[model samples]
Target: MTKPITILVVEDEMIIGAKISLLLTKLGYEVTGIVPKGEEAILYIQQNAPDIVLLDIHLRGQMDGIDTAREILKEGHKTVLIYLTANTDEETFNRAKQTRPFAFLSKPIQPQELQRTIELTVERILVQREVNLQEDKPLPQETNEELMLLQDRIFVSSKNKLVKIFINDILYLVAERSYCQIFTKDQQFILSVPLKSVEHKLQTAQFLRVHRSYLVNIKAIDEISQNYVFINKKAIPMVETAKEELFKRLNKV
Candidate 1:
């Protein structure tokens, strides 16, 4: 039999925290602890480690959620950090990405969303482990530029740290004022890059720039109508100019 996934909930809101904890248990995960602040959460992890951690961005006490996540990652624990927050602004999302959490869920999370996220995160962890086993040799040091290709499964470097991301696990990429919001099948990742810049890095056939503000992976697209394209469960608009190009790209894909 497989061992159950263990999760720690670090949230300030008691009532909502309890609700999420209950949902996690219902989804067949073990709730290690539900902490009400950042400092306590850190201490709990140091004492007893869990498989994953459900963290809230608006944490209480001296440290915020981001700080706690950074410290935890610094400790080199493989626990995947799933950030629970309502913020989606460019600055906030980029700051959250620096920690390189495994997943991100928006506020007012539905039960289905929460459960699917847990499943996907666990699968991602397994994939990473498999990839790690393939090559015993360590990655070389000192590289200036990176050429990453996001496919069914992918691994990329962020801040000199190697992070594996499953592309089929992604939903869409929303271009913010100066950053990009990478939404996955059950999560989101915000990166520091312009839409045009990231656009050039991708193979034009797989990723489509549906809107001036959105660049979506064609394979992850579920539906496309006259005006909008569906990425995972979210609807993103498609302007007239990009419509023909989008179809051509989709066909080529």
Candidate 2:
């Protein structure tokens, strides 16, 4: 059996903290602790590490969520940090970006969004662990049945399990050193595969290799301008040959 995903909730509001803890339990996660202060949350983290942390940006005591997150992330563990806040100020958002938290959620959180975020975050963490440890081995054709490709979907390795994802959801893929950053409409994933390997697995004409380091979903393109095409607000440039192929595929009317 798989071990439960452990989480720590740090929200100053007692009622909200309790509610989050209850929701985590209902979602089959183990709640390590529900802290009310940034300093207290740090204490719990140092004493007993959890798999994930739901930290409130505005908290009691000297340290705010961003400060605590910086300290926690500096330790460099696989633990994922997600911010829970109602604050939407540019200064606070800019400060939070420096800590590189996995996700930022607003106050009065919806259960569905929370659950989805947790699930995807856990998957990313698990994959990162595998990458760090070099535990993923290439299996033979017959044995590598876990990852499957269908007409409209594909199953990719997420930790020890295979998770199915829709093809249409993929907006773009960017090379991250030896890994690939798979961007979807609302989420992103890191895959321990080369850019060329990803292209092979995709097996779809719509996913065009625009740049040597970027593969984009043609359907997701908002506009094509000169040497670049925009997808999800990102400008992806194409090589000479790729540019021609892209236009050929479009066959613009």
Candidate 3:
């Protein structure tokens, strides 16, 4: 059986903390514990590492939520952190930004917003686990420049290092005779794999195979003609079947 996702709430106010814990329980997450101060949160996390930490920016003690998150992240813990803050000031925002929280939730949180954030966090965690497993494997020479897809981005093997590229940055992908070429706004990368092989792997909602030789980002489409789709001023041939599919996917209004 799959274990429920564990959560730790770190809020100074007792009423708010209790409410959050109750809501998490109702949402099917395991509420590990609720702590008032950053110091207590650190201690709890050290003893029982939860899958996610819902940290408030303002706390009861000297160490605020941001400081606690920083310490947890600095220690290389696998726990995902989400900041719960009513303080949206620039200074506080910059400090929290340094901690690299998975997502930020404003105070007086709605149930739908909280649920959505948790769902996205779970997706990211699952994707990270898959990427880590792929990274542990030995690289084959024939597939030197391989790409690992994640929830929001992809990791590409480049010069013996993994380079992170967000899906939003990608413009399109072109199928060469033997390899697949990935084009972003700044540079292009060639993966040592056939187009068919990549099509199965790039099975995301955003990417579409407009033709046998091209996979285009739906958001990157600049213009559409009868026979082609323009992306970054490059025309990619659109087959009759794919063109029909693309039009169906587009919003009517």
Candidate 4:
């Protein structure tokens, strides 16, 4: 029998942490434990390496969530991280982004959003496991129509088969109602999933949501103006707040 995915909840508030644990259990995942501090979380992870970690940003201990994530990586843990934060400030967001979390969940979490995020994360984790197992052998032909997201690349369905697209190659994504269009330098691909779903899968700091309908890769941007960002000579609209944040992120001098 295949082992069930294990998760650890590192939330300071016991009530909220317990609620999350209950939800995970209902979703058919094994909750390793719920710790209230980053110190205990690190110790628990050392003892029982969970497949995923749901970490809260503002903890009651010496280390905050971002610091804890750094320590986890420093210790060579392969567990996937998903951050929980009520604070949406740019400084906190940027610090958390530096750790490269699998996803970010706001406080007072919605059950459906949590479920979708975990499900997508699990898919990526399982795909990575398969790739690791087959490292010494040839990869099998892709027959599934579902898109597969990896750490640095994604397998997108195209012409009845899956095609590998490096994440860096993707310039931006535009949401068209229920569909999302991914634009690269020389190609474009349409996905059946919504923009939010794609954003959840992208854990890198390179991509930023410039508007409700657009997610742009900062590295691929050619120029930024007051109202728009230019990529490959294509102008994409940006919100005021997003533009300000982007300006702060870029080097001015």
Question: Which candidate achieves the best TM-score against the true structure?
Answer: 2
Compared with the true structure, what per-residue lDDT tens digits does model 2 show for residues 129-231?
5456553665334323434779898777655566677999889887745666678888765666676777898877889998776799999999887566878
Per-model lDDT? 0.73, 0.79, 0.79, 0.82
User: Where does candidate 3 stray beyond 4 Å?
Assistant: 1-3, 139-143, 146-253
lDDT of 1 at 90: 85
Model 3 quality (TM-score): 0.59
Residue 59 of model 4, lDDT score: 85
Model 2: residues with Cα > 4 Å off, grouped in runs: 132-177, 180-205, 208-253
- The candidates, ranked best first by TM-score, are 2, 3, 4, 1
TM-score of each: 0.57, 0.61, 0.59, 0.57
Candidate 2 TM-score over all chains jointly: 0.61
Tell me which residue pairs clash in candidate 3: none
Per-residue lDDT tens digits for candidate 4, residues 93-199, read 99988998877888998886688678756755764554354444543344223468888999886656788999999999877555577889998876666778888
| Candidate 4 CA-lDDT value | 0.82
> What 10-residue stretch in candidate 2 is worst by lDDT?
138-147
